[model samples]
Target: MTVPAHHPAPELLLDYAAGSLRAVQSLLVAAHLAYCPECRAQVAELEACGGVLLADLPPEPVSDSLFGTLMTRLDATVATPTPVPAPAGKSLFPGPLRRAIGAEPEALEWVRVVPGVHLSAWGVSAGTASACLLRMAPGSRVPAHRHTDSEMLLVMKGGFSDEFGAYRVGDVASYDTGTPHHAVADADGECLCLLVQDQPLVFTGPLGWLLNRGFRF
Candidate 1:
């Protein structure tokens, strides 16, 4: 299982292996694993490591009926498939990304960034924080810049490259807003990424600031 040039760090896989990643985030990781068998082995290895650690641990005291109860539920589940969390609405959004962000999911209002690039701002009611869905035309590149807050880039389709490495479909790039970098795409190929961010975007130049100010979904 060859990982991309810049794959999620081991910490992320540990979180996933521990089931700490959110469902949405986990969904993307599952997709990435589909492409990377080496990472798959690594995850399995990690899980095995965890299992060994558990083997040495003291067994938890449990009621005698615990085994029977577990078997009962496992038997029942065989007949009924569990429901996947999808959008609850009259009509679902047009894309996988939209549907993945269900539960009072915001709309994707395309706002022009450059001639070939677009961004859709998404807001949440609980916080001033928001996110975005970004699209870039083949070969287009956003100005290299730094972020002020943490950002999550989950690729739904296409790919991009930066100083770190190239990211293809199903890849996620998490960055610290305090750090800075530049990203670009291959010529004539488009890439769509779900940008989950909570802080303001720090533009590197005049146009960048203007675009950020006017950016809205």
Candidate 2:
């Protein structure tokens, strides 16, 4: 299949390869991997590397009672109830996210913004962060903001700019706390991106102060 306009960051992809992402982050990356053969191939290479390393580990014989101890631990873990289905609201980009994130997802709760650009909260894990999709009109300026935690952007369509450079489709950018970044849409068309924010965004003024207090993600 053709690669989507955007690709997940190599770091994020690495995390996926390393199995280090949060459950939701993994889900989104899993969706991306499902569609992108290139990434799938990369992940396979990583798995191969891991296998080689595993092969280098010293072999050791197991003790007999180790099996009984492991089984007791597994039985305890299995006894807990499974998680209930997510409520109609509060679900974040359940796969077939495209099926759920769009002009008409009543659950999306689109935010009010410029006439052309659009934004909506997709995942909210509380004081830690949330995921969002932002669409910008040609030449629109996305506000400059200070990061309290990490920030990542995956360009899905069109392009945008920040102080660092223009990010076209397929480019992934990342920033950690204290970094400053901003964007303006491409001159020719609207830009849409998926953002997994690590901390609440801090605007440049009083509003930001209020937001900082109200929103930690």
Candidate 3:
């Protein structure tokens, strides 16, 4: 595989290494890390720094009841049986993503959102956030839209290009609130991307009024 040209911002990687990123965001970062050795190395360095910081911090006291509760939870966790791993097979999604969605991408039932665009929503516990797989047919273009909050896209297969730049497999594109852009899939092949958004997209095209009317993207 070609090394990805795009990556999560340094601050985002720092949050990921510190274990402070939201679950959905972490999932995207993990998928990107699987394809990015450079980012993985950076994360490792950040983690080491975190460990040093922790060592320098003073210890805090824990109440007996709290400690007992933690022990009980730990015991319960240990008593629980390990889940069986999914049978190995060919797949485009990364391990974190496959586990989150509970299946391979090909096994998902996609819902057509537009003429040549499909979506498969993955129900996960992300407060005020949504996670899904977006698939665009070759040469298909998503209508111009603005993000309501932050949005992150991790290319799983094929590629797409927007005003910012072209994104291929393993590339991560992040957009902040109110940022507007149009995306078109590569002409030769369909593009599949893992998308996590803090809020639904806000369409900014001529049909924006209709598309933004209670439509969840």
User: What is the per-residue lDDT of model 2 for residues 1-217, given as tens digits with 9 covering 90 to 100?
Assistant: 2455456777777788878777556655765665577888988888787788789989898998999999998988867688885655542233444543544344455554545556765544644657777777888876566877787776766788887777776555667789887788998987876777776677775455644443333
The list of candidate 1 runs beyond 4 A from truth reads 1-3, 23-25, 64-109, 120-132, 152-156, 170-174, 196-200, 207-209, 213-217
Name the better of 1 and 2 by lDDT. Answer: 2
Best by TM-score: 3
Candidate 3 lDDT over residue span 148-217, tens digit each: 7988899999999999999999999988899888889999899999888888777777887766652464
Candidate 3 least-lDDT 10 residues: 208-217
Clashes of each: 3, 2, 0
Ranking by TM-score: 3, 1, 2
For residues 83-198, could you state the per-residue lDDT of candidate 1 as single tens digits? 88675455322244445555322345567776777876553322444555778889887765567776767665678877777787767788876767667876747887767665
Question: Candidate 2: worst 10 consecutive residues by lDDT?
Answer: 91-100
User: Global lDDT of each model?
Assistant: 0.66, 0.67, 0.85
lDDT of 3 at 132: 85
**Number of the top candidate by lDDT?**
3
